[model samples]
Target: MKIVLIITDYGSFNNFLSDLAIRLKEDGHEVSVITSETRVINIQDKFDYLAAGIKFFYVDFPRGFNPFAHYRSSKKIQKILDSIVPNIVHIHFTTGIFTTLFAGRVKYRTLGTFHGLGFPVLSGLKKQVFGAVEKFCFGRLDKIYVLNEVDYKAVKALGYKNVEKYETLGLGCDLSVFNPDNFSETWKASLREELDIGVNDFVFAYTGRFVNFKGYDKVIRSFLKLYSKNSKVKLLLIGGNDPIHPTGLTENETILMNNCEGIIHIGFTKDVASYLSITDVFVFPSVKEGMPVCVIEALAMGVPVITADSRGCNEIVQNDYNGYVVDVTDDNWSGVYEKMEQLIINKDYINQFKSNIQQDRNDYDRNRYVICEKSRYEQYSSIEK
Candidate 1:
């Protein structure tokens, strides 16, 4: 079977598509990708975009629409789809391009994978309000995929049937790069030395983009409360800043970054797993999420986790079993601070988070779950085969 993935964000380094492409090809299916270019988007630009034997088609999807922009951009995407003639179309986060919707015009099967935007109100409502338009856009999809249970229900509530909700491949972490054995204890200790952090200092880590909804500001406030007492806790914020546009950083984010207390902005580092290995605890306080790959990486590395109470997160940590999940809100931060304090004060708890991660590591491989994606795409695209 041939598989083509559609994504609104694509550059040299993004792994979401690259990872999936490798999985599909290793399983013997031919794969291709249609990506929306991000000139200023560096999140996934460092890695080889064409690593796997997959062809990539570029289209400038009107990420945000203007009448003229949409007209030209959408046409460019449509032309490429016409040429590729994919047997199966897989759409990821349909923010910029409308090509998948247009592809629905063909007899081929198409599927949409919901990575989810973290808003309590189910922010997907914006595109879906236009039922006829969405129906036409979706174009006889064989299946629509959701990573978390909330994502599944959100799409279903939109009256979208023929949906498949897959369990996460706890393998969200790149085990190849993130393997616990890859870095020895001495290497991790070197990281502490390089950062000028004392070996005994309680180092806490918060990774992922520093956007408001991601809950970094809340984490800083909680840290202030912790620091007021002069606790030894220190933090490392990975991806704490994005280029202030060729234009400028948004005032809200800029203010938050400038004022973040006791936080070390590492800028962007390719050596995530190494830093993650040396960290004492992994903290996640996102207001919304769809199975954060960051937390999964932390778990696979055997670090204890603290995440905001959200459905996608619930699916990962069973609250007090694998980790702690408090209702994600600004007011409940004190309780979150308390939980981290317990782990900080107790060495045994940190040992537990590490000792048991290997037990659950095999459960989240993208191959097992992602295969269902190809299977569904195949079943729907063909008739009486």
Candidate 2:
């Protein structure tokens, strides 16, 4: 079977779907990827895919809203689809799925994996607009795979006739890479020393694009407040700003992230596990997500997470068990601070969460996710379109 995987950026492919692509190829399927070029695209990921005998096709799939850009992207996708004539078109990310669906008629079976629904987190007019767009696009897909219960429920509620199946199979983490046992105490201490992180410091890490919706500003503000009260806490930001997305951080927030003491902004690095190894607690306050691989990775590394009570996050975090799930609705982040303070002051509380994570970490392993995805592809490919 010849399969074409479509996504918004090469970075997303590298971080999330690269393993699945390689697995599909290893399963004897001819696989190809279509993505937009961005600074986040790791050249190593590109070469790795090429070496694995997978093909690459670049498209201009912008993240922001622009009808003209979407139209142009749809045309480019249509051309690619015509050229490839793939058996299955598995599109990821909302932007990529929308653009490819907007391409009008195509012969291949379309499968989309909604990372998360933006409309659920959005308000009034924007929510209505996105909901309508989602309904239209979803109605055209042959199959759908949602990463979380929230997304699955949202699409199921739409009751699209064209959608043959939609399941909540989360985007899994590479447990072998993120496992805490992989890193020794010596390595952790050495890395901490290099980063100027004190051995006794309670590290709070957030790894994602520094964007408005991600709520990095809220994380920074809360960290600042905590830093003032307790100087032993440090915040490690592991991602860079998203230039293509309209939700990039504000100037003041950017400045704070870069200039704030006790806050280390490491920009972007593929070595997230190394940072996670030294982390005491992982903090993600994003307003929305599909099933965040970062949160799963943190859990896989036996690091407890403090995240928002949003769709994807609330589902992953069992409140007070794995980590605290703060209610950040209507810009209420007091709970975020309170939870951070609780974890900081109480070592026992942190240890308890780590204990729970150790028992349940296997639930987020990448091998299971890959096998499930491969089975789906094989099943779909064997069916006559």
Candidate 3:
């Protein structure tokens, strides 16, 4: 079966997109990806290399809610759909309402996987356009893949009956990159040395845009709380440091670092899986998510995750079994992810952390999710007798 993956969430050799393409190929399905732009400067080389083996289409993303932009984007996608007519059109992220261009072009199935809470810049009137498009696009679909329980409940409440979350069907990671078998003693030694991390010191990592809604502040605050009591924990912040957010790292991160000890700040880089490989615990205290790629990546890497008690993150983790989840939004929000981020680091934490996932890990495999999605496409693409 041929599948078209629409990505409006991210750009530039992204793990989510690449993993989907490669895994779908492995599962015997033709895969293609369409996106707005890479958005980041100087990453074109990496993107070009990635596009070599994958089918890619790029459209200029209309900045404002211009009617002309919608006309252009829709026409571009319509042309592509008319030419290819994929069995299933899977939307990974919708950039603005303009994404409705090809949402329902296929006569078969249109599966929209809500990737995250709306982009931070979207609010009030800007959101109206998105709602109009989403309602129309979703109405035309055979299925909607909600990544978390909250999104599932929200969609159902919004009057959608045919939606099935399949948060498990959301993008997973390459477990091999994270597999301990692939690690070389030399590489492991150098990585530890370069990060100034000791063999024994517990490494706590939180990966995501340093934005307010991501709950990075909670990681800082919680880490501070933990540092005050015990100085053994080490903190690592991974993501682009954007200052515009109410909780962006520019202002708060400085305060967070100054007030907290045993912290390391590593800005944007493509070696996220490498970082995940060494990390003992992964912390994400997001207030909202469609379904987080970062959290799923960590889980696939076999690192236990501590995320917000919100919808998307909760679906990936089991409380006190795989990891911990307590919504810190109520109060003491600062020390949230950090507070629990340390739990996985502490070798002594014992029963609180499930060191070995074993058979439990199969449920979150990327290959399995892709297969399920492709199966849906095949069944829908076939003529109903």
Candidate 4:
């Protein structure tokens, strides 16, 4: 079967769906990826996809709200669809869904995977508008896959009956890459020395775009408070700033991230698992997520987490078990600070979380995700026949 997967940008494709595309191609299906030409596509990313026998098609789907741009993107998608005439069309993210909606109706088996709904973070007019658009687009799809209970409930609330939750929890992590056993103590110590981190330092790490809704600012604030009290604490920030995003970090936050002494901002690197290996605690205070892959990766690395009580996060983190899930609201991050302090004071708790994580880590292996996705595609193909 010829299948086409649509997403927002090349970066997202590289991060989330590249492995799936490769696996599908290995399964003897012709798979192609369609994404907006927004970010600069890495040459190696293209080479990897081409080598995997997957095709690439680019369109301009603006990340932010712009009706004219979306219309143009939809027309471009329509042209591509006419050319490819795929047996299956699978959309991902809000941008992909909205652009496909503008392309009008098609005869292909349509499916969508909502990473997270935009309306949950919006309010007033924006919330109402996005919510209505989501319902309309959702109803048009033949099948829908959601990452978290919040999204599943939201789709069901809209009376959409074909929705199913991703059973592997989020998109699943590459266990082979993120496994703690892969990194030896010698290698970890050498990397720590290179980064000027003391062997005994309590490292708190976060890996994701430094955007507002991600709550990096909240993480920073809490870390700062902890650092003031305990000088042995260090914050490791992976990933870079997104000035184009609607919720990009403020000038003050960016400046602080750069100037802070205890916080090490290592822009963006593909080797997130390496950094996670040396981390004692992974802090993610994002206000919203569709089942954060980073959290799963951390768990796979045997690192405990301190995250917010949001939809996807709440499901992964059992309070006082693998990690602590704080109830974060607006500017109130006292709970985050308190949790950090608890981990600092009670060192035994960290070991306990790591022990619990070892037993539960296999549940997030990426192979499971690949198998589940392949089965779904085969089911659709059989139906088409």
Pairs of colliding residues, candidate 2: 115-290
Ranking by lDDT: 4, 2, 3, 1
Could you arrange the candidates by TM-score from highest to lowest? 4, 2, 1, 3
lDDT of 3 by residue, 1-385 (tens): 7777776534533656665566667667777777766543112233443544567787665555577777778678767766777777777554532355543355545667666534222469756766675666667666776666666676687888877877364666556554655677788778978988887777888887777778876777677767677676788877765444555445665676766658887777666777877788888888767767777777766677777777677777777777767666635564464446456455555333546554476666777666676566767768441
How big is the RMSD of model 1? 4.1
lDDT of 1 by residue, 124-213 (tens): 765444333344444455666667887677667767687667655422656667677888879878888888777777878888776656
Off by over 4 Å in 2: 39-47, 161-169, 244-257
Off by over 4 Å in 4: 40-47, 120-122, 246-254
Taking all chains together, each candidate's TM-score versus the true structure is 0.83, 0.94, 0.80, 0.95
Q: Deviation in angstroms for 279 in model 3?
A: 2.0
Please, what is the whole-model Cα lDDT of each candidate in the order they appear?
0.65, 0.81, 0.66, 0.83
lDDT for model 4 comes to 0.83
Q: Model 4, 125-239: lDDT tens per residue?
A: 9889889878778877888888888888877887779999989888888888898888899999999998889978989998887766777777888887788788888999887
lDDT assessment of candidate 2:
0.81
Best by TM-score: 4
**What local lDDT does model 3 show for residue 365?**
70
Best by lDDT: 4
